[model samples]
Target: MKNIKLTIEYDGRRYLGWQRLGSSDKTIQGKIESVLFQMTGEKIEIIGSGRTDAGTHARGQVANFKTESELSPLEMLNFLNRYLPNDIVIKDVTEMSERFHARYNASGKQYSYYVWNDVIPTAFYRHHSFYVPQELNLEKMEKAAEKLLGTHDFIGFSALKKTKKSTVRKIEEIRIEKNGAMLHFTFIGNGFLHKMIRILTGTLLEIGMGKLDINIIDEVLANKIRQDAGETVPAAGLFLDEVFYE
Candidate 1:
């Protein structure tokens, strides 16, 4: 048997997220696994680095699966791209050691969120980015985002109801950039809790609009209050940019 690693890119607008649901074909994992089964004649299960919420896109998602098939990695890649939906694409495939597990081996991840910060919404990026008609104070948003960097218990920023695991995750960087009417936010972290990025974006936007105070970031972090954080923004604006492995 051989372990195969796959680099994938997908537009997740129509899928039900990454996990394979029982008897549900409307998922990214299910769609890929189904193709794998067809190619290998086995119920091959691909393990993703992490899950992306519905309507969340991925520019460079990583996954791995062990298979008994004799086909070459390039052959497997070709077969997958040929049959999978147009919205999903297999970018690369390579053979890996049996010890290589996509999730466990991942060291860090990079995510990007896009926002349209103008009154007029464009038909092109309507589905790709979040729109905030009110002008945002970019300077304040940047100042507020700086507080989110470094290690902290991010439970207040996450949507997970209960998790026994530690919420003390480190955010290496949070960059907010403006390109015309578009605002691009990039986050690099060791790991992200459920809905953490969306919540962070919402909070920053609120601060930018003067709906929340810059000092509130310190309050939320210190208090660990979920309700104190801003709303969870739409998933459409989020993207899994890349997964890092060491």
Candidate 2:
């Protein structure tokens, strides 16, 4: 058997997130797995580094699968791209050790969120970014983001009401930048909870809009209350920027 690794990129507008749902074929995993079945003549399952929410895009998503086929990496890559939809691309394919697992071996990940901070709606970015009409206090938002670094119980920021696993997560970096009318937020961390980035962005946005104070970060961390956090931002603006294995 050969352990095959794949680097993938996809426009997630139409898919039902990254997981394979037996009830629906409109999923990134299902789409790729189907092609793998056709090529290998077996039901091959690909493991992704993480799941991307519906309408959330990915620039450097990674996945791996085990196969008994004799196809080389280039042939597998070419065949996958030829059959998979145009919105989904297999950027690279390579052989890996049998012990390599996409999700378990991942060390860290980078996510980016985009916001159009202008009154004029952008036809081009309408599907790509979230729109906020009010002028945001970039300084205040940056200050709030700084407070979110380090390890903390992010229970309040996650969509999950409860989980057996610990909510504590370490956020290594939070960068907020502006270019033209667009505001960009980049988050790098060991990993993130479900919708944690969206919730974190929503909290910072509230701080930017003067609805929430900078110290609200402290309150959320101490209380661990989900309702006290900011809105779970739209999925359109979120992207899995990259997945790091080393």
Q: What are the lDDT scores of the predictions, listed in order?
A: 0.94, 0.94
lDDT by residue (1-246, candidate 2, tens digit) is 999999999999999999998879999999999999988898998999999889999999999999999999999999999999999999999899999999999999999999999989788988879999987999999999989999999998999888899889999999998999889999999999999999999999999999999999999999999899899999999989899988
- As a TM-score, model 1 comes out at 0.99
The list of candidate 1 runs beyond 4 A from truth reads: none
Which residue pairs clash within candidate 2? none
TM-score of each: 0.99, 0.98
lDDT of 1: 0.94
The digit string of per-residue lDDT tens for model 1 on 66-180 reads: 9989999889989999999999999999999989999999999999999998989978998889999998899999999999999999998999777789999999999999999
Candidate closest to the true structure, highest lDDT: 1
